[model samples]
Target chain A: MIQAEHLTKRYGFTTAIQDVSFEVRKGEILGFLGPNGAGKTTTMRILAGFFPATEGRAIVAGFDVFEKPLEVKKRVGYMPEHPPLYEEMSVDAYLRFVATIKGVDRDKIDSRLGDVKARCGLAEEGSRLIKHLSKGYKQRVGLAQALIHEPEVLILDEPTIGLDPKQIIEVRELIRGLAGDHTVILSTHILPEVSMTCERVIIINNGKIVVMDTPENLTSQLSGGERIELDIVGPVENLPALLREIPQVKNVSLGEPQNARQPVLVETEGSADVRHLIARKVIESGLDLYRLSTQTMTLEEIFVKLTTEEETQEEETE
Target chain B: MRNYLAIVTKELRTLFVSPIAYVVLAVFFAITGYFFYIILGNVIEFVMQRAFQSQQFGAAPPPFDAPAAVIRGFFGILSTILLFLIPMITMGIFAEEKKRGTIELLFTSPLTHLQLILGKFTALILFLLVMLVPTIVNSILLYLLSEPAPRLVTMLVGYLGAFLLGGALLAVGVFISSLTENQIVAAVLTFGTFLILWVIDATAGTGSTITNETIRYLSILNHYEDFTKGVLDSQHVIFYLSFIFLGLFLTSVSLDSGKWRG
Candidate 1:
């Protein structure tokens, strides 16, 4: 439902976003992953039509954001980095104001308010002044305002920045439940949030799109080392020699000694798990394998490598 | 029109929800009450002196030199008060929004810049009306107490003129508010600007004695004079309308510029 082409934002001598392009299909939860000053917020702002892009254009729900901003604005709900709330007003009052300004139907406002409050777990606190609420509640109120209009697309920036772990899970569950109904593009630096909440991940660094794919795909693509650790009851010294014969095992290192047991980290070049073969080989070699543990590269490692501040190393290697 | 109503509601709700509106109203009434006290005291003195002169000099000139002098006096007094009052009410209209980051919500909404400006300007007018209530009470009491009786129509016209003048100044205030996110800067600059306009009006008179008028016409007080004399000149009407329009236009332009840089 959203398409950005060669989007760029420049301020004087610095470029906030540069030649970034991507597409989010309908009903897909696209997690925008990046660090601070990584053009994530800038890109979201352009998509929401709050600012015109310095170059190219963005189309949301079939309307060009720059050429027809009002139409785009009417169809997209955006929660900025801050909640964009008036501290003096109650949560209900603030949501009502947003609904009015967003051109939601007069008759549907009450129903929409109820729906949004329930969805964001804010049904009981609508009458309280926003300034008086805790930070987590404040962030939820911001989300509720964005959802009150019932727009087709939701653009949330760092939606869970200041919440406790339980609150974070609740908000994540709320976000996860939003999929299949509306197109969502949430930008956050938190890694597991994307892995848990998104169907697709777009990694951005230095104002450029590094890669776009499913989280599983990106992890595997960058998971260059998946090791299997074995615990045996036999000798530890002869363990490395027998495992070297396996074709899939590229290199192995005896893990630094730890409490009660010795560990090993393995790097593999093949797609198959070598744990079973290594285990059998150890039994045949008469070595005790006390522990067999596998470590696979998660989406976090992939994201860090993709969006790391060390841009040149990854760019040249990729 | 729906956009306008929505923004108006938003502005009114914001204006009433905070203590600042009440504080501003109270401050305005207090200052205006004090100014009224001094002016009433002086009016008593002027009338007494006129009475004494009549007894001594036989029908000495009536106190009013020309209606225009009173017009100038009323405008001068109101303009000075507005110079202080406009910024307090207006500095937060756009500046506070920018500072608190609520302007993002506003800009991203379906409402346009014109709607936002008009809504804020209307809210300011409502606050000004609230300030006018006590002034009306004062007018009624003064009418009952004065012997020769103040000119009811003249006073009514002068008050209406003051209202319009405040509207124009608040529009200017709104424009100034849009230029910065610092309320203090907005208020200070707004005061400085209106003070300069008042000084210009006092110094720059209708040009040559013959077929007069130069840059004195640019003064806000110059344009506001017709209303104080109970004269609703079409030219003055046009002038205030243009001034209001210019302020609003610039306010809209500033908001639009902010969108680009966001």
Candidate 2:
């Protein structure tokens, strides 16, 4: 539903996004994950036809964004980061106005309005002025405005930035539900949002795409090996040697010992289940095992590593 | 066309919803009403003076077209009043949208720049017509009171001048509004531009040189005089129409440049 090819956008000498490219299939939920100033919003804006890319092309809903922007805009619904809204207008009036400008059929406008209001959980708040609503409700109204036209593609920049925990969950669920009916591309600095809602994640940093993969794969691929953290309460001087005896164990390191309790970290190669072996080895060694748990690198760690890795690489080259 | 109407409707709704519209209407009506009364009193006073002089000299009173004089004076003051009030009407047209970040919604929508410009221009024109309603009623009242009613064609032509002049200024205001995101800045700049255009003929330096003639012709007020006289000169009509087109064209260009700057 969306194809961006080598999309580069520059404001004078500073490149906001450089040589970035990605594709989103029909009905797929694609998440753009990056730190601040990572070109996430810039890339989305290009795809939404908000502005032409400085040196690239985007085709949205099968229309070239630069050549036929109106057509692409007709089929792509964009919700900006700030949730562009008129505070003076009532929620219902605002949505209806958006529907009209989006070229919604006149007779079907009321029905479409109702549909989006219900979908965004804004049905009862229609008559209330938008400025009177809370931040979460304002965000929902923004979502409703984007959905009013039933466009084939939805581009949302930071769709869940300022919401309570429950509102965040509801918004994530709403976005998840939008998949298979509307192709969605949402950008956010929130890591778990991508994992929870997107089928595919694109991690961008410093005007470049660092990595792209499924959430599970991203965690596993960057972790190199699974780790098991063990808390043992016994003489632990020989624990690392004993745990290393296991065939699948790649490395073992011990934490500071205090009150006769020692923590051990065991790194194992491949995806093999080596926890039972480690526990058995600890028992045979006469070390009383108090806790044993497997720990995989989280998306947060992966994000920090990938983003910082690029920074260090640039420093090294410099 | 549908998109155009949609934008027009939206603009009208936004205008009426804001307090500025009512404030502008109240100010316009109050000032114009006072001026109307003063001008009527002056015209009546002049006629009574003439009757007294003619009775004293024992000669029939010379014909005095009271309604014509009143309409002429009314239109002259009306234009000056509009000179100040138009910026108030158009200052927020584009500036507020830019400030609130709704310009993104508009630029990304399926609507063309021309459609957006025309829709806003049309909405302001409609509101201008509404503002002129009481003045029209006042003219009708003046017509009814006179023994020989005012010429309907002349009254209508003068109104046409008022509408065109308002539109031309509004078009200029729209262009100025697009140049900034500050409403006050837009209004002040628009007022400044209108003032310059209003008095540009003074700079012609009393010379018959081509440059001087061109400068005199460029003054918007100079062309408006013909319409108030009920001449309906195609030259003045073309000038106002072209002036409107030029303002709108520059607005479209400004919008495009903004996209590039982004």
TM-score of each: 0.82, 0.83
Which regions of candidate 2 deviate over 4 angstroms?
Answer: A221-302, A305-318, B55-64
Best by lDDT: 2
Scored against the true structure, residue B195 in model 2 reaches a CA lDDT of 97
DockQ of 1: 0.51
| Per-residue lDDT over B20-132 for candidate 2, one digit per residue giving the tens place of the 0 to 100 score | 99999999999989998999999999999999999999999978888888888888899999999999999999999999889989988898999999999999999999899
How far residue B26's Cα lies from its native spot in candidate 1, in Å, is 1.4
CAPRI class assigned to model 1: medium
Scored by TM against the true chain B, the candidates give 0.87, 0.97
